[model samples]
Target: MIAPAAAVTTVPRSVRLGYGVGSFCTATVGAVPGLLLLYYMTNFLAVPAWLAGVVVTAPKVWDLVVNPLVGRWSDRTRSRLGPRRPWMLAGALTLPVAFFLVFAGPSLRGVPAALYVGACFMAAATAYALFEVPYKAMPGEMTHDYHERTSLLQWRMIFIGAGTAISGVLAPAIAGSQGAQGTLASYRMMGLTIAVILLLAMLGAFFGTARAPMTGAPEPDRGGWREQFAAIKGNSAFLWITVLACTQMLAVSMMLAAAPYFAAYTLGDPRSTQTLFAALVGPMLLTMPLWVRLARRFDKRGAMILAALMFGGGTAAAMATPLFGALYAHVAILLVGVGIAGVQLLLFSMLADVVAADAAETGKRRAGVLTGLWTAIESGVSSFGALIFGIILSIGGFVESEPSRPVRQPESAVTAVLIGQTTVPAVIIFISVLITLKYRLRPPAAPAPAASG
Candidate 1:
């Protein structure tokens, strides 16, 4: 049931920016691991491709259980800091330290190193959920106006662009450029720098949202997981959107996991990973307003379909890079970046609407639980990208090696990276477009008339 926009007082500029900067946490934590972790394990830790996939994936599957639990906990928490911020604070404190340790470990290799990375990655994933699940729920609580949520998430997308640029472009440069992909010091430097970025962004969000107004949300107690599942089952909009977004995430994750391999082996340069990231994220810095306008004109679901087409087209076009060369790949990725800007902005904006609509209909505080379930599914689905790519690498006979002992991969392995990054992701994205067609959600009721007094 859609609720009236309920005369939502526009969120303050300070609070909006404060809330917006939180994506720094989301983007960095989301990007760094996908961008670097798989390659890091394969090249530096000497973990075989298939086991490395398991190490990356198992921790995220753990989130399928943990994230929803934290969401439910925050939904019930009572404090001066509010239900969400307290958990945000907790994640801010723990994730940076755990992230640092994931890369800075002893010079262990093979299965032992894989185990160490898995444990630390698991801890980092837990910490991320503490901040992310609750933090994502805030926009739904911040304002009820449908258009206003779009405005608010615009600020967030800007920060997301910055965060992704740092993680996607700068992190790779630090890891691969300073020495090579084979240098322990290079990977350590990459880990430390990214950790510091995570700390600053997470802390900034915790403090920035101090003054934002919280519209009331469902305060349902932990009524057990089955009840929670029942609530999710009943929200059609929420279910459809989650399915749509998770499919999109799987596509993005595959691209991130295969990027370094694609650059080093297919494109003939390791440093090209940095340039590829720049092309992928650069348009985002300037395109949010255009996306917001598209949402206003076409509605979010329509805009999402258009964006999906662009993304899928770009991904498919890039498959010709080996034939057309790197310049063509960069241009194709630029189109993907423009599409990414719209999709990223609209996905969360529409999500806020779904949660807010559910709150109005149910009269229960299930934002945490709902967002928890959302995060858990998104994280778990995304892990499939890395896992699938890892399997591809194994089947293609990609060789694993330590930093000090690099190995030449087979011609088949290079082809595997190419197909994984381009053809597979393109197919997944087209499927998401089909899912988007099913997500015919109503926008929130139009804003109530304003008073002049």
Candidate 2:
């Protein structure tokens, strides 16, 4: 029989706040690449659209191997600080250096520059995996209370929204300017600024959770990697949740990748992209508590279904902006933000419960392995979003131009941008809702008692 979980009954607010701050690091790293990397490669570095796609997508292939290993490694580790904190600390120190190199590569053009940027980004991706997998695992390790897990993740989601908004607003405003070289300089400056913020946020999480209680002992050495893989294969709930989460992640990534183009081509002003992004993300902060309450009152899957409908309806309404003007589009985007908030808050919370349930069934806590797989799928699919949008742009015959010389897109390309920004994500969100319905996980239960001798 499975043993009862020795989970911390109450986590301090300070610890929760500290953990929540780590989202700032994740959001800054995630947002910068999704929001600007494709634009940087094509517009500033002058790489072809197809090549830009390859460069951005290639580095993430590393995560498929690294994430699982890191996850398992942390599971086996025994440390003075904790199994996860060392990885978190190491990631905190190295990520800033990698972030700086991503934008500050030597002045080279064509394949050479693409190679340099790709190599730098691979390092950044590694650092992110090291931090993100362990950090995600903590929610399961920190508490076993089903409702409390949702509450903890709610704070993280709130900060995620805030951090996304900060990066969305600041990166564009900093990078907006006159010429190609000037724009490059602006990106470099923005990179450095974001790097500092990432470091500080990560450090805060490391120290803040230093004394938080751990739930279970590390699993004893099993057969090998095959055994580890087998563990994940048996968890049907985790598999379904991964699919549902990955679809939402891909949709969000595609929208982020297409936002600048949509602003330039459809809204007729590139600067407006930042404002649109802010509109899309700001409401998430205010709406997260409501989402958390909904999840607590009903169920995460139900909340996700509601979110998907809202997101699809909002996206469809935004597609009609050409007829009604930018004001109508902004309101529609706010609704999308609300939907995104619900999805983000509920998905991770649900994953924590899935992990707890797995522990109950198997009598081992392998949160790292599960969280690793989760992060790997999330990173891999999101990166592919860049490639998908790139193919769309290439097929529509998008015009490539330097910052100093703006080019007007043909109607076909403009239409492609609009479709990418709207219909694509709306459809993906609906599919995610369908997948979520298949997820069947019970709430946390007390362990059954051992039989008498």
Candidate 3:
């Protein structure tokens, strides 16, 4: 049987733009929290490294449950605004407010402060799930053509680069330095700024995709997720892609979490956080079109392998930052940024394919569960990167300090930060390259031409 919308070869550029605009939500939310939140908790709030890790990660644990439920709920809904947009709208209303409170509330340090931040972060995570799981579900439903999905996701990659660039560079500038000393007010302001950006992007996507086609059938899976899990268990391509995405995201998250520490201790300049991010996101922005072409030439599998190797090698080389100095580290990270473009584009594009293929085969609306599980894995491992780095810092005896009470980090802490950012993530990313080899998503064959009378 022909799949739904199989004959629809192209998504309108406007709808692509509208859908792609939502990535600002993912990139901004993902980059800012990973970049600054751990540092914010340890330095500004005086939370211990291990506990700060918990504050960053605990909220994401909530995702493993909530994301799937949101996915399932959307699959069942029949609404005038459509199932996904309503959830997107709800998230837009709630996340910005919750995100602002994360940094703006309760100046008290230690456990009291940690609890306040943790609760706010949990709320933000839930809000993110509301939009993100449903948002993720849309690309697969938008069209069925394999290459068209890549073309569609090309827009998302560009927007992701922009959002990541804005958040990565701007957040550090707004949050002050690593110590952030005596400038809690600046951190609060940064939160407000990021919140506003999130609001605008989410709302823009809602309005932008005003005429997006809902090609996927809305026959909700009545059986619980156990049935969906069984379906996923048999799907090898889906499983491998999930592994690749999760491992890569974990590495990215670890590096993002360690950026502030690396700038201050390893590079001897806290301001270099902005410079490092500029280098990182600059390459990401400039190379996205190149990566999209590479996906076409090499196929997503070969392209992913190349991208993973580039990221791992560049990140591993960055471990020598102390020996080579700032320029060398910057150049190495720039190379890593190039790989990041392909990694994200291919991963997202392939995900849409696998989900769409599954929906076509089963003749059920299981994309929600599939995407829910994917997001849960993505969100879980991504946040786990922070937890892993916090463990590394604790082992190195890093000290926590209030904004008014600055303290020197031991050489051991500095070394730990460098290793956490470079060596650990490099190894993890290389592991993803191996998993990428296991992915074998076959593109659907084109329909036969009609015979002449």
Candidate 4:
């Protein structure tokens, strides 16, 4: 069956802008906790390092249950507003409130505080699930055009990159200015701001793309969840993609966890944190157009493979910290960041094809279910990433707020940090590249024609 709205192609420029901005808001709210939550819990909130890891991991475990369920439900829902948009609207409001509570949670001074924080995190996780699952599903449903999907995502990443850049740079500055309880207050402000952004995005997507057609329901599945799992497991493309996604997520967590440490200890300059982060994401903003050109020239899979290799090579180069100055670290990370930039821009486009192909093969529109499962995996990976990094740091003997200045550690521990950020991810990225190569996707025999620019 021809997909609805397939005859017409190319989303309006305004709609694309709206999607990009909305995505930015979502990414900002989502990424800050990933970037700062562990540090905040372990250092600022005075939680035990190990316990902080638990806090980071706990909510993600819920995705194992929540993500697939939401996806399945949305797929089954019959709504006037469209299946995905409703969830996005609800999540848009819910996310910011939950986000604020996560940081504004009761004092972490006692057992009550820990319980309070956990509860707040649980709430935010639920909201994120609501917001993110639908947000992710929209791209697949938005347009059937393959390159259109890439274009949509390209803009989305632009916004997401901008949002992450703002939050990453500003969160620290905002928290630092607030003094003792300032982080808490800063979080509240950030949450409110992010909420506004999400709301705007929701409206734009809801209204701008509201007229866009839904693929409607998928054909019946003979079995239930068990069968679904079996199908996905049997699909080499999906399986490998999941493996690659998980590895990338783990690697991302490792890099984020180690970045601050790399700056402070290896470079002996705490101020370098801002500089490094800026360098990492700043170019993404400037280079997004070029990234788009490269993606179009090569297509998503080729782009992803190339990106992975670049990241891996750059990561390996980061190993030469002693051999080169801080500039080496900056340049290596920037290269890795560039590779990530391309991957981030294209991975979802590939997934859209995977979902569509599965539907065509099975006659079942299980995008929501599949996406939910994907969300569960993505969230789980992110949470696990945090946990994994914490374990790495703990094992490396890194302490927070040492009673003494210039706290000394065995050289081996420092080496571990470097490896965690560089080599470990590089290795995993290479494996992911291998998985992507193994994936064999046959596009529609007669694909739709593209619109002229």
Candidate 5:
């Protein structure tokens, strides 16, 4: 078991900053696909809505299997560069190429184009799993300090907000050049730009954490795959946190996937997507400190509950946009942003605590196994969210708009967009709040001092 003092020791500012930089890449990777991929295929490439959903969901399904394997491999790894950094470096080299292929595929329509995207996105998701599972495991290894973990994740959320803002605004702007929404050329440009940013940010994390200490206990045995499964199955706290986080992730994913459609049809201004995303993400940057303070004063679980309510309420209220207009809707979305910041800032911190408790109990470090399950649930649930929304869009009979021509959507399709943007997420977030209420974790005990020499 790690001593309390060792667990509570403060992380250096430099190491914190270096680890935090990785979130920039993560946010870009998450936001672009959630926000644009469905739109890109259905509207830009003229793929059917159901097929587009398949393209988006297939890669994540692959992650369900790959993440755990990578996690277990990372756990057993022994290296001079440390168990995690090598994987981070490998991800830095491969993720850019995989991401580029997602939007830069051959100009083929129908099933062929859809198949191409599915294959490329599967590659991207695999590369991301290589980096993310190990990266998430690092915070637990970095420090056992309860509050310090939250503090570290707070820095990560800041960059997540920044990266989301950049990708949300710039990607759409580039893709919708001169109000010509869903141009293939625009998507290609956006993909190239994001690919470069992903490579740089990931490499920064790799080199930055290169010399940082590895705090996880040395592997006791070469844990088998069955042992990894048993480890996660036995940890109740891990299960609850995974459920809560993935549910929230599902709600957030739905909103992200629905944003473009809502702006195009419900708000009557597709160009407003840039501003809408700004409103949803900008306040998150400013309010992250406020959420951090709340966590310090209260508990992380309490803070997360409050934020979930705010998110659900704000999303429900935003449905009244037709009555109150775009300005009013933006205000509602800003409230949702506040909730988003709280969840993003605290969930991983809580996960780190869970990892610590598991290590203390088992006397073996298995951060990789736990974090692998975490990332897998997040990826799977979020991708499932996209699939659900795509089915809704198809049911509503959404029309695929041409780049140089307008397409009229049915009234039902517009209504479907409204429901996806508001009611669906509102309901999902409410459920997440309920599940979070069941979480039970107290701060780890402080370690006793050593005997006098």
Candidate 6:
């Protein structure tokens, strides 16, 4: 069994770049819904708040069952194209199908709506898992170099930041132009466009590194599912990383699901959702290179702590929206987005490192299982965010059919929504930071930085 010590050389730049692009567009499959689906259900399609929440959350069950299987299958797969590319091709082609269907408006006003939306979401979830799980595992296959992996992840975040901004800004605009019902049409267009982008990225990754050196398979000592399970269960670092990753995803999901409602009812600017989103993310794009520099100087864990605190502080500042009005609230939220970008970017890098560390210890390249388990946990977090927020809204005196106007609720209700989106997540992110502190993996003294293929 070879230990992936700090002595590994850096990943090549071209491989890292190619992987980053493909992964970014594929990841958009997961993130696009988080940004727009809630808006579609609540305002455009006219689903009730409670029902909308359920519709939003119902697909995660598939994630738990499907994601791991795909991971395991990828781990065991032997192909001329490589373990990940075949699935990547299939995912890129199929993703648009599920993406288009999710926005197909069936009057989700009653049982029929619930069933319809639930079915659509399930298809989309499965498609996303197919695309995302394998897509995520590619970085590990791309390089064994520690610093080079970080560089690859850094480039990945750069592209992810760009794609996410476009999708977030465009989804609502396209839908709004066609009217709320036309939101479905807008969604269809977005899917087709993203699918094309993802396809191009897939092509890059597939062809760019065809001649590159391949990573060796798992050691003979590691055999079958039981061995993989033992490796993960026994690895304390992997366990903690999964927990922290899930919690972080949960915090993000709640905010993504809740932001639409908060913008419409709380801030009273439904149109401003895009503006707020852009404000939040645009700065992140501009500031990411700075974050990359900071990560190099201070380490990813410390940067994550700074980001969490910044996000928490921004959220706390936004709580004063009633006093200062929407303008100030928007600025505060923008700051929150900037903070979140660092966390989002760093989390991917951390996961890659964790995968590397696991392989080093376990003597198996179980990247598929690790990525699979990570996706499964994230799926749970996504569903939990939707479910818990729905329950919270019901308790907060939020009524589904009530016009978009703000309603008087118990102080607790307002406080609850605010805290759920802000304070709760802030606390969680902070706790995640504490947990990451437990990681003692140090990079090589002269570590080779990760790069794109």
Q: What is the TM-score of each candidate against the true structure?
A: 0.96, 0.94, 0.96, 0.87, 0.96, 0.87
**Tens digit of lDDT per residue, candidate 4, span 111-183?**
4555666777887778777767776776766666666677778888887778777776766556545543245
Candidate 3 lDDT trough over 10 residues, lowest sum: 1-10
lDDT of 2 by residue, 1-453 (tens): 123456546668888998999999888887888888888887777777778888888888788889988888888778898889999988999998998899988876667878999999999999988888899989887876777888988889888998999889888877775442247788888888888889989999899888776664356334477887887888788999899888998888888888888787888777887889889888778988888888867777788899888887898787897898878878999999888888888889888888777766676767888888888877887788888888888888887656656666789889888888898888888888889889988564566789999
- Candidate 6 local lDDT, 1-453, one digit each (tens): 124453454567776666667655544664677766765665555566678777787788678888888887777777897776677677766766666666665444545766777887788777667767877876665566755666667777777777767766676566555642345566667656755665676567556655544453454233677876787787776677677678777877777777766666667655666777787777666877777777888887787778777776787787777788888978898888888878777777777777776666656667878889888877777567866776787777664442343345566656566666666666766676677677555554553689979
For model 1, state the Cα shift of residue 448 in Å: 10
Tell me the tens digit of each residue's lDDT in model 5 across 394-430: 8999887557556899999999999999999999999
As for lDDT, the candidate ahead, 4 or 5, is 5
- Point out where model 2 deviates above 4 Å: 1-8, 177-182, 217-221, 445-453
Model 5 lowest lDDT segment of ten: 1-10
Candidate 5 backbone clash number: 1
Ten residues in a row with the worst lDDT in model 1?
A: 216-225
Each candidate: what lDDT? Answer: 0.88, 0.83, 0.88, 0.70, 0.86, 0.69
Which pairs clash in model 1?
A: 218-364, 218-365, 219-365
Best of the two (2, 3) by lDDT: 3
Q: Give the Å shift of residue 214 in candidate 4.
A: 2.7
Q: Could you tell which candidate, 1 or 2, scores higher by TM-score?
A: 1
**TM-score for candidate 2:** 0.94
Backbone clashes in model 2? 0
For 243-333, candidate 3 gives per-residue lDDT tens digits of: 8888999999999999989998999888898889988888666887788788879888998999989999999999999999999999999
